[model samples]
Target: MSGYSGTDCQIPSVPSSFAPGHGEGLEDKGCGNGTWTSVEQLVAVPVRPFTFTEAPQTITAGGQYGVLEYHGSISKPHHPGEAEFYLLRGVLTENEAAQLLATCSQALSEAIGSGKGRDLDVDGRPRFAVEVAELGVLDGKGSALRPLVETVLLPLVRQKYGQTAALSSACFRRFVPEERRFIPPHQEYDSFAVMTIALQESASYTGGFFLQGSGKAFVDRKFLQLGRGDLCIFQYDLCHGVDVQEGSHLELVLHFKDSPQAVADGSCPWYSKMVEVGDPDGLFGHALSLVKKDFPAAKEFVEKACEQDHVEALYTAAEWFWDSPFGLEESQNSSASVELWRRAAELGHCRSRSRLGSLLMQGVPGRLQQDIWEGKRLLRLAFEQDDPDAAFHLGQALLQDGDRDGVTKLLAACAKGHPRACFQVAELYREGQFQFPKDLRQSVRYTKWAAHQGDAQALSNLGHLLINGMGVVKDEAKAVRLFRHAAKLGAAEGMLNYGLALLRGSGGVKVDYQEALEWAQKSAALGHSLAHQQCLGGSFRD
Candidate 1:
């Protein structure tokens, strides 16, 4: 249940020994030389195969050269993982990223098509303008992509790095023109790295050169450009980027970090049981990101959340577990989620109490043991807590138990503002069972209330009352309207009634055979017996 917290910092460069094959010869230019310690010392170690149960943090710090520092703990440390970053202050979430990318790509394409900003680079390539926004998460399309990144990518990085690592907040910004001049030699210093996968192809724009850094000379360096989904990983300290030139701006940044945790023995319980099962691919990182996005106390809880906040925490944990195939046995079928609900119910969490009561009532085959009396008791508890659904259920239970007074009292309480309860009262009245008087006026009132709540069944019932003149004065026009509304809401009986109304032109309504046929067809599709017979020219319709 460990959470994450961090602060952004700016560090001056400290000269350090050049790691081989990390562009050793090139002069350290942009940010001064700094012998930054291993990424392990900087960030909190994580439990391997992490499944984030909460949201991410939102820290605001801006500068050409600065570090966003985060502090958080994982259940176990030795496992490997990867982290994704996004610039929250500038634009929010993936929707914004898609919009910005689409706009910039389109503009760059138009400029190239119009023969503007199409000058050739030093390599005689057409130049195009591009915009680059760094610090963006690749999977911001929605909650759907979180599973993919958390389950698939982080484990892969961990495997390659041999240990878990911390993710940096900085994303890259590279605006490359179609011209060759924009390509610049670069290298990084982190032990392992990965780049964001772009949704669109690079060829759609002009003057985007991805140059691989040559440890050789600074001025005359060799480089290579990349296409979407292509990744480049090397020693942590390689310099890379596009040489500034006119073209569409592109964001190209690499995530850098060192192994954060010490590797554990394969058989350790915490490592094997919790860390492995809990975070199979470090999904917890993404979960943190989501928690940050949705909840207000994301940063605080991520940094210090415990199991006591189990209601929200367990729900998030359940979601993460449900999304991944790894650790299915331990995480997916969590007793924690059920226990959390039970605890909340005990604490008078109305929704949780209602849900627990409903679950008790269901007696899920092979999961929940059957106990109708217990279910009724729970439902009654929830009903007393003012849960509308619980009240409705309690009424049904009491009615079945031959407790007419109890049923009437509970139903009345829910019926005041709850449509389902109102419908239930109408149903009891219509049946004339349990010694309840079949008052047409009361039936119509309750049914009307349910219909107003958009209950299709109630609307159909109201239509029947109006058509038969059972409650209020007969009004075929009103009946037809009710029927049509119910039919639109997918009420099969309503379709049949509306069709019949159209066919007969009853109650001052117009006759339309075509419309009647359509409604009849729909009703038949929904298994309305009379409508089906009518459509098939059987005896029922006549």
Candidate 2:
């Protein structure tokens, strides 16, 4: 075929296969060959068997012209899948590679350094590395090749090998002189394959040998050096890494397999050992890794646990997936947890219903929101089912919505045995906020009840009442005891109040200037503005 000049590269001026004006602007003018004429129509043309030595063929048929460099292909051993690689040539420079590597490495390093990555790990240990693929997406380069690789090349590989295929990348410091030796030695996982191709040549320096797993004896020592257009394919369950002898840089295009069952099975050889040893984070890090690796089967397995007949199993699954510190976008898995809890709730799991209701009420962005009405309804159901926490939440919701009658009913039920409910009832009665009578006597009654149950807030409230003689005779000694009790419960507000009482000698008590100053300072540190100002000499004087 004769090469076409720049002007000749344009579309034909006159339509040759169809009537000149008949198919104008018709999105898909069907040709007799069953092919659509529109540029938007994707027709999967079978790729011709082009070897590495053959002239580079346009994988994207009927498209623009560009330089291409071929990388070798790999055929699946027991499967029919095959993977090939090619470099779409452009003016990519070493500086760009270095900058991208440095930026990605720094970000990963910072993430690991800041405890975020550690928090993401179940055991709170650092990962080998955080591999972020799809850098092209973040860079805004719009690599059309990604889709081509995913849709066409990946499917072709899977079809040829009879196993699934995946594509991913990782940021590493292979180019950094000091960090070159830290490259992964070699490792393998089951029923998986990997193919990596260098996007740019690194003959300028050294190192980066793509070695295959030889045997159990000496895994890390095996090495193979590959050039720009060379492709390295191996089983997923093998150990391998580039032994960078001396290279300025090497940017790779990577393809691998993402096992659906691996998610549920947690069978990744690389991480299974970590899970077995009960690594510091328990199953958390491994589970998160499975999620990150897109092990759909593992995800299904976890989901299945939520669907179990046992309430405990369902609750466990929900909590496990929901609280997983791994920052997998909440929108992705939170809905699954929500659905699980909803199912459990429907099955008369009161605790599950309460949990689901709370999640719904707090609404995660792009997931659910805090629906006060729904939360109240769910909490009411749970309360009817005799769940104390549900009663507390129902009463709280009612109080917030100014539902005086509902709040009174729920709070009364909750206060029957629940100390928290007693405190709430006392607060409502004291403030008369939810249409309750401002009965200081009843407030003191419930506050005393809650205080007996060891509630710090209740004790503090009771102390205030006693000192001010609001519902009882002013008793400085009694108020001091209550304040001290609440302060002992680690209540910051209680500490501040107790300090103030000690300092000013309130309730017919003597004023100790030094003690008052110390307490005021403590309260101020706890964000008590009045106490803070008092410490600064802004006190009530005789």
Candidate 3:
């Protein structure tokens, strides 16, 4: 389900072939002068597609200096939200592209080609020749490519979806040749429509062709033979992927969704517009801009903005300070950060209160002075305010103290989809620790919930259970896949488990001593004790 329907609305089959670009093949379903007795009847009433046409010149004349082709779906109930795509042919001059490439390449060097602990595919090879995190480069105010999306891409989406669609994700993807380069077909989630812009000439890549799949067989297939600026749009639910053969390829993907509104009195408003219209100095706007960039500067900016008594800035600053590596100074004394959290908590920020409580439980003795009683009190207050984090932390504390009330609190948090609480509940069920009953099936179920939220430990633990047939049928291949995914998320334990699997040739994984050794070394570097021993001991024979 989408926000449109709680129950599964019928997903219609893709028409064999429709107009390729723009609103060329829309049928007018005239329901003129029809009276509807209820909202349901009104929805059932057919509507005609509004008149729309190709407006490349109009778009270009609006200070959009680019040579690109655009294809858009008509805004109608029949269409699955605003779907549009652009081909980036000469939209960016060579000089401009080169400049952007250089700037981003330099800015994101660490993230590029730096697979610190990513796992190999089943073939024991890297997934891509190069997979750059180009989003990091474009997230800041300094990014040259920001305007291309904010100025051009967003406006095009608004033209099709009206002004209510907000940009969900704008991603720049680069694919290069590798031993196994083709992407497996997959479906997208959390978005209504996806628009992809080709950034490279077809000749640059070999055999890497985009195909639209109906989650099974291919409905339509197209090679990269289209010109660079050729654009494609598809409903997010439609399965799509590229068959990579050789050379390099680059693309820009824009995901759109209906903007969530704070005040949904049936009249929807763009979330960004609400922010812009509320604060006089656009304080939230400035805070958002800073938060999107380097974390250190973002912290400083939020701190300065908080001086103006901006609640959002106070909460944002507290959050940035609470997150490790981003907020923690090298000295590791979080007294100053804790004070910020306390200040935000004093200002009635529920999340900040919860965060402050959690930090206080750590007993970080400093300017704020750790007090267990005060921490628990704040946790109770925050929990009463219906803060999920507060419930999770308080539940954990209570459980540690052998209090049964923690079980109810944890279940409440789990019901709300709190990943940590789900993981905790899963652990309790697995071990029958504290007040939980021993149930491996329940463990697997809750672990799955946590894993889906990207909990690395849950993924790794679930892999173990899957391979051992603890609560489910044994699936060695699935276990290996889960371990690989968990390892890719920088889980040291996942790396060690995956390495051991390679060493023993378990989970259908072929024995590759060199690869196993590499994974062992990586896990050891991340402070996994067993991996350290595995790295030191020459037990695996090549």
Candidate 4:
């Protein structure tokens, strides 16, 4: 343990935290007196956990995200109908908000006289931009405002980009009654999305109008009604700013992103100072904290660190070169990558051992020579260390070669919520494939679990089963909604099924022939065979 100058093996290399989307609901309890009693789980909060809900099938304003309307209808010609921002009312209590504002206003008050922090004249006003990181240690305690922002931003980012937003940045802002008293419509390029929270009562400020707009002149405006302790979050692309008049107005501005590359590489001086002190873990962390945002800087830093005999960086670099962003790419023909993994594996990097073992067992042509015995040995070592990837690869290989022990390995991966392994095992149980007896209950369990991760195929499959009353109870309406969601995610089968459901009114939903036809066409374009019949204007059949 002393010799290994890398991450401790006891901790998991991957993030395993997950919370399902649910709203607070009540159920009536039956009483002996033939009456019903209702009870509630009360919540008193600094910030309330937002209730996760999906938009029902309807053509109207604001489905999931808040309404970002173009014309009267939500549908814009260029992009799919999705709002850029939403409102969360009463995230904090007035007292809690006062605590936040007191910090910001106090910092602003200090910045006005003292020659600390960067100086700037925002909109011709004598203002200062003092970062929260500097004031974080004011009372020798930095409130976890960034983590709080991340918790709220995570689900929204996933809904927008189909992935997680892992990092966040924040600052405090104040608007006073003097001067023009507002920043005009402008967007910050430095963030994926921005969370603008009202730290004081709307009654306190006369004209603190938060507006979002687009175009050169910025004419079309959506003036949002953000009250005290309320949050108005919008994407970076949306042009937004606020105006305040006749009173003191304060706000907590926060930024979120899928990657912390910018934050790590000197965007925030506080974080930069922490990572600049030399550690491959920082570089490796940036690589893992990304999915949709294909940042080259993360790859550059991690790969560079690996060349310096950096243990953690080499493990990440191997993953980057070999099969990055969820092991979807195995065709990369870089022998240097394998060698890097080998070096890391020899140095007691557990994940490197897992990855290199999978590759060496199969052997990339002209890149790696097959050595199944050694590969299995390495995988066993990693599996003994409880690496999920090792468990999957080892289990899949063994199962394919007619070994019952492989199922245990696949189940091991499934236990860690590995979606692919879950899908594999689910399909096996459903079809009775690879010596697994057909177990609809087990199949449904795994399929539903994988679908929760927003896998398009898993969603489509689960919908199919739900509609057919296979494994689970019949819920055609719910299944149709799943199809619609999966279709939006570019699943061909989902598109086909959703089109059919819409056309036939299978879900007790309103029939829209035009929309059904459009979905059918999309499915057909994506090579769904069933869609061709409908797209060709033939008789409807599934």
Candidate 5:
């Protein structure tokens, strides 16, 4: 290969001995083979020094090579955000670039093959964003790239971002013309800064450009071009995206977050910090680690983690926000949940897509903006993925829109043993809501299926059907057992029903006023109105 060169960038050439085939044992892994293999032996580290210089004159408008909008601290003053910009110019030895590219490609292929990688399209194309630690195969000596990060990249980051910034995450990103993946503009959080290192030969690809701006509106944007071994560093929260007009693009992205000081030992094998900090997944794991140490509030941890390019965290955090699991305020939770779900959905989390669809279908006056068309599109995407929950929710949404096939979708979910879906099917049979006529047998059957799966309401309702022989053979003893099971699971109505049955000697059980009173009192404590009334009236076995 010819010596590396770039516009306005000077890089030294490597000796011919370091070329692809010049070294012994280097022939084990062939280059450009298009097949990824495990790293059996550690390859010798290339001795190439990377260097760069800042431009003397900065231009404002187009035709300028590089300009910075923000630099110093990454976050906004007083508030919690920051941005920084740096341009690095260097060229890797041909052999080093080839080895690094091969390592990343193999890691990506393995992740995709093992189902750890996210699918961008229904055709099973992999998403550009990949969490390196999530692959589970590459760790410590297991990864050929660990030495590169620890020995080479670590000190560089510390020199640039200062020693206070902790290593947050590293990801492998690949863009192919066939996939035609265009990342929409988005901002990062948790990370103080992000560094992008080019691995592929830039001249080989056409029409791939990187853009970053201060605001979501691309009013003022800076486009950066990086050659092989070149890198760029910028604030994590800066609005950024990639536009691929043609060929393939590949890069390695490393992020840093402002964190408590730790020993900055470059030779200490920094990748091991991933395991020690419980951030092996490198999705929300970094923020989750902070939450574990009480370094940040749970809500803040989730908020920051969700903002990073972690799609799985976006989905899980959306659910957490909607469910108010970590004590987030309700109004904020609902809005944040929907927004996060939308972001995750856009990034192609099928489940998140379905959830956003459900939320959009609601068309709630203020909480979630309505977009029926978009909602249906997302729901269909999820439904095609065989997600039972998505099928159940989409079926309901379609039914509300007067699509009769929604019933079929619900039944499909029920067939998959989705407990809530089974309950929905049972309700449809019980009420004969759509075209189907009322069928007590079908209702009882589906309800039983749900109850067996620990659906609390199903247990109570099915117990009633059993006691009254509403749709099946009467089995008072079994009814009592079901009610008791439900009550223990914190079903308030189940508690009241069990108390009443025991008090009246119903369900073929011997009457026990003491047991009945105790159950009634517990139900009353749980705010069951009927149970409260019975307890207030001191009426057991009345």
Candidate 6:
């Protein structure tokens, strides 16, 4: 493990090698030679502890460096809103920033391994900027992130918002200069608040970190110039985005949701404090905490918030009574669910309106009276606001009425990667149903889209097409792979097809008759009649 005797440390920004419990000599990278050991996590510390940045007012200190809240503006206010985000300077030392950056790089590499989370072009995401992997990855357990989140970040949240929250997820965002990556102004639809730390110096990148006016705030549009070891904090309610014009920008972003489990006792004084101070949102958060713990008391809390006209709570309360958890209908009161949704819909809650309208149109048995006219009206209102589910539901209703416009609406939802919508359009194209003018190519295209979004049926169907060279060029090898994946996803047809493939050793796969029998048995058990016929009728791949 012998390495460098250098007194100066420049904090290398690249990640350490993935191998654990060993030192890799990094003389070539030249931030001052050192071995990266597990002891330092991602840090390749020099022989001695050395300070990097001087002082920006030392309110926070850990041995050598001081972290202070930056009171000055990060960017000039361009829009009509107050600054939605604030910064803390000197939050990490050069070595620590390097460590954090490495951790983020490795985690993102693992989670986003040649895969995409969002459907392409669905959210207007630039192909280059859409590295949206599922956050927290759960398997990683945020172990590498615990010290940073629990110790460094959550304390800042408590200090800033007076709200008790915990880490729900974390994601890595790397804006590559070669890819010309950048993010435009948009509020996060996913998290309650966001904490992002710059893993590199401000000079490491250019033209990034800007905020815009959103919600009730009169915040001016401003850009932040963060140095190494700096922290930026804000609620997702605040409109913000990033812009990177030059070098690569590595950001370790953490999303925190209001969780009572953030505290050991599953309770927090700040929630009550906010509630007592008349913030209904606090009561809503508390109710969610109770619901997460399956405490029946959550029901009363949610109802109380609904009484205060809390829009979100009203919508949730309806759901609470409408559907039983995991089919335990004993707790469900569809009648009560309809009442709450009716109230929320009257207040212009889009989802509530859509749900209530669908229930009314279908006539929920022994619950909602049939009211198709009012139902369609409410659905149309929500759809006019571009609610995708509303379009899908209304399309279904209209399709039952033999309306051509129904397919058009379904097409709109399909474009948004709605699986049912995609599957319906695929079927229409395949069978010329509903005057869709049978286009097998369109069928294949839509089926591919559905499969990419993880539709098991579409996956099996695509495999079927590949096997027969229908619409798409035949590739039995690829087809078999798709069948295997689909079968793993629990598609009964996929199991049947995969079993046949295995029995015949099709597409370079070794023959495994035993495994084939297993898959055939599974598919037959799942009620795939064709599966039963295939094995019994001697329909092997050959």
Best candidate according to TM-score? 6
Q: How well is each residue in 322-379 modelled by candidate 1, as lDDT tens digits?
A: 3323334544543544665665555444445556676677666755566687777777
Deviation in Å, model 2, residue 277 alpha carbon:
25
Models 1 onward score TM values of: 0.39, 0.37, 0.48, 0.44, 0.42, 0.58
**Candidate 2 segments whose C-alpha is farther than 4 A from its true place:** 1-307, 317-340, 362-368, 433-435, 468-475, 488-492, 504-529, 532-537, 540-542
Worst 10 residues of 1 by lDDT: 1-10
Instruction: Give the best candidate by lDDT.
Output: 6
Model 2 residue 512 distance off true place after TM-score fit, in angstroms: 8.6
Candidate 3 regions with alpha-carbon error over 4 angstroms: 1-281, 292-301, 321-333, 364-369, 490-492, 518-542
User: What local distance difference test score does each model get?
Assistant: 0.45, 0.48, 0.54, 0.57, 0.58, 0.61
Which model is ahead, 2 or 6, in terms of TM-score?
6
Off by over 4 Å in 4: 1-304, 319-333, 359-378, 432-437, 488-492, 508-542
Put down candidate 3 lDDT per residue, 373-468, tens digits, no spaces: 888888887776545577788887776665555766676566444566777777766665542456777878877776655667777877887787
* CA-only RMSD, every prediction: 26.7, 31.2, 19.3, 22.3, 22.8, 18.1
Instruction: Give the local distance difference test score of model 2.
Output: 0.48
What would the per-residue lDDT of candidate 5 be over residues 63-114, giving only the tens digit for each residue? 2234332232222221134455665555244566577788777877677545
lDDT, candidate 2, 1-542, per-residue tens? 00001110111122232333433332343443422221113121111222355565443311223434344444321123443433333323344444544554566566644433222111121232334453212222224234445554455456434454444433232333322222333333333455554444645545454432221212213333444433444554334444333434444434344554442343444445645664422233344456656645445444543433434345546765677535555534666677677776776666677777756656677667767667767777775544556666666655455443345444434323356666766665665543345677767776776665567777777777777777788886787777777777755556667777756666555777666556556656766556566556656333
User: Which regions of candidate 1 fall more than 4 Å away from where they truly are?
Assistant: 1-306, 310-340, 363-371, 505-542
Each candidate's number of clashing pairs is 69, 35, 6, 0, 5, 8
C-alpha-based local distance difference test score of model 1: 0.45
Checking candidate 6 for backbone clashes, the offending pairs are 78-221, 79-221, 81-218, 81-219, 81-220, 82-218, 82-219, 92-229
Name the better of 1 and 5 by lDDT. Answer: 5
Q: Predicted candidate 5: what Cα RMSD to the true structure?
A: 22.8
For candidate 6, lDDT tens digit of each residue in 136-189? 332343455566565667777766665566665565566663232334345553
- CA shift at 54, candidate 1, in angstroms? 40
